[model samples]
Target: MKRKNVKLMMLAALFPMLCWAAGEQPISLGTPTGEIQGRVMLPDVERPPVVLIIAGSGPTDMDGNSLLGAVTLKNNSLKLLAEGLARRGIASLRYDKRGIASSAAAGKEEKDLRFDDYVADARGWIELLSEDSRFSGIFVVGHSEGSLIGMLASEGNAKVKGFVSIAGAGHPAYEIIETQMSNQPAEVRQLVKNINDSLRAGKAVNDVPVGLMALYRPSVQPYLMSWYRYDPREVVACLEQPVLLVQGDKDIQVSVGDAEALKAAQPQAELHLIENMNHVLKSCDTVDAGVQQATYTNPDLPVVEELLNVIEKFIKP
Candidate 1:
């Protein structure tokens, strides 16, 4: 009834400002902060399962690319995944982060965008999908930092039947930072640890080392402090539903060990490793650095069939 009317309005506006080509329709919904923009990609089949595609960190748009079309590493990974899912009769909704691209009006939340804000946005989108009668079930597919966001959003959410984590960080932010700082001087590592400790204890460190001011600056501390409280392993363990953790062997940003850690914490969650797949969801065979890096910019590359196959089975089943 109400859902049908909204769809009719969307359909009637086919000539005004909306484009519904191939079942992709622009959607805007009001939030407590502001309005968030997104695109709902629908399958031709009736009552298809709905999956919310949560994008990763930074100002990443609905397509897994940077906002305002920044030329650097503008890969259409998430966009391709939606198209791939549509081909298999699965529907998805992907959106720009607040203060990013079409969702710019939602910038009111960006300056103070703590990690929980992202989780709230994901939760809002999930509730929106539940309102639509054309969907059979709801699933959350989060990539990179979005994994944490989606996991937190699904806490006690009855509508979210399952979760798919793609290239998500396995350990907490502090541990990951420690691992990445292995090459830095021991003193630098120690300073980071002390700072992280203080923040974890709800104390802000006033004396940030000059060498590391860029990362530990006052402006970034609030968000960092909020994110420090979450441990991926701990969060995954608390989830009672079925979870799918996917990792690519060739990914440079997130390692296979991260996926393994999550699986270890939540033994119930099934883990799948895609051979030769990169972080961008592209299937790159070469071990050569040049070729592997090229995939980040290659928009035409089809998302790995194996990745799509696994997700389709997870949702449809």
Candidate 2:
């Protein structure tokens, strides 16, 4: 279907003019440990602004697809965004996290990655991009949890010019998760509360329901704990580079409060709150569940032009 066509087109491009309009192509960044899987597209113009894209959490690929039900790779936001940027004379690099995408050891190791492992991989990419002459400078666009990784990789690093935090969490991650769960049905909310309480008490959450266990398991605990150790506000405050905050006013996952928190921490960061836009940066449906899930399946939907304009203007300056 649509996904197939897009992927085919992305891999078949030759000339640079419409290269960004093409689908996602495999990019290999040779790291110390091994090669990392990613997709890179350059604009038709030479020496375009290079933007590195980092995806959110849980099996998300370079294209912003997640394994969650009702969401597929077909609705990949980054895929279209990168392609759009290419058509606009911007270069981009988007990658699958270690063990995702086309990595040879994918299924086996993705489940075991630590937070530091992701940060190290990002650093490696930064180093590689810095050495390349085609790119003027690295501008990192991090979505959701990837924003944290981008900040971690760019702190005190002179190579990165700026950061675009899209749907990023400003407070502690667990706090945001807890807040969202608090409004769920009483049973679901209570179940999550109990599991969180157990974790906070230094006890294993094994007895929690299977639905909750998927998000709170031993394999993910190390990362959750590490994530709790730093606050996005604190991290952003330490970063000297320019930052742009992009948030969807209707996004149920991360609220405007998150963006406000970031702005308060870093007064210089630019904030762009797109009205009616959801977590995925697409036009949302008026209905409840429809809007939250629409962007996951509709690749034709484009991100808010206002947001893109802000980013382009910032990078150009």
Candidate 3:
């Protein structure tokens, strides 16, 4: 027991050195609401380009885990991506969105949360990176719903050198939701369409049905209204910085056609469609919904190698 204790002490003393060698550290940004918490992964190289990685929708933390009810979706996709970039001589900063994980104190009341609030937080991070001298350049990488947030944040920001969209939808949020609900019964689909139409018109839906209450709850309708106003293609087309659009053919949630549509919007942007890569950035052999969902909880599964390669080239090239 004495020998084991000594070894543990030695390992604890060496842990900081190991982290320094990998250039991993906790970072934070102060906002009017609260402090937004994040993790920064830097390479050993001097003045490396840093990418701000914005996570997808919901309660996704800095490491890409999402809490759905009692279940925690523990795919370390963003964490692995940051580590991979650090290994390739690039730096990255990934954060828990306001009101998520460590940054829970920064969350606003559900009724007061606007989509622009997220955009503001992302812009704050960009400004923070701009003031840091250790980074030679700043890039924005947005995944899923974050793609739209990053687009709005990077639109007129001169400090943002580039933007990358991964597994992003090309249309507005309402259209995407409509597509996802197409398999429901005609009555249900029509009900959803009516609710969406009301939200799209800048109206609050107060009389939500019991069956659809979870999705169209009163507190969340304001946020949905804000989210439905922007078309991603329109936003991406306005970006002055270089853009890279990446999509996976096997991504069950987002389609490759969405990336193509984004490319069509910005003719100068580069588009790469990776084969067999799923929404979580893992290479799944099949597109079975159950099989793809398994990757979401499997932290041991590493993200696709081509994802790292393409992102590295985009940032360094």
**Top model number, lDDT:** 3
Q: Model 1: residues >4 Å from true position, as ranges? A: 1-22, 67-70, 108-111, 286-289
Q: Residue-wise lDDT of candidate 3 within 1-317, one digit each (tens)?
A: 99999999999887755545456888899988899999989898877899999999999998889999999999999999999999999999999999999999999999999999999999999999999877899999999988999999999999999999999999999988889899999999999999999999988888899999989999999999999999999999999999999999999989998999999999999999999999999999788999789999999999999999999999999
Indicate whether candidate 1 or candidate 3 has the larger TM-score: 3
Mind giving the per-residue lDDT tens digits that candidate 1 earns over 1-317? 99999999878766432422458988876787789999999877877898999998887888988644446677899999999999999999999987788888887533376878788889999999999877888999999999999899887899999999999999999888888898999898899899989888878888998988878887778888899999999999988778999999988889999999999999999999999898889998865678787788778888899999999988876
- For model 3, the stretches where C-alpha displacement exceeds 4 angstroms are 1-22
Clash-forming residue pairs, model 1? none
Regions of candidate 2 where Cα sits further than 4 Å from its true position:
1-25, 31-34, 69-73, 104-111, 184-211, 285-287
lDDT (Cα atoms) of all candidates against the true structure: 0.87, 0.78, 0.93
Arrange candidates by TM-score, highest first: which order?
3, 1, 2
For every candidate, C-alpha RMSD to the true structure in Å:
5.1, 8.9, 7.7
Q: lDDT tens digits, residues 1-317, model 2?
A: 99999888876664444433443456787654567788888776767889999988877888887765664645778887787777777789999887775654533353355677788888888988898776788998899999888998889999999998998899877677778787688998877767666655556555656777778876766566556666899999998999999888888778888988998999999988888877777777443765467566777888767667777887886
State each candidate's clash count: 0, 1, 0
Per-model TM-score, in order, reads 0.90, 0.82, 0.92
Q: Worst ten-residue run, lDDT, model 2? A: 14-23
In candidate 3, list every pair of residues with a backbone clash. none
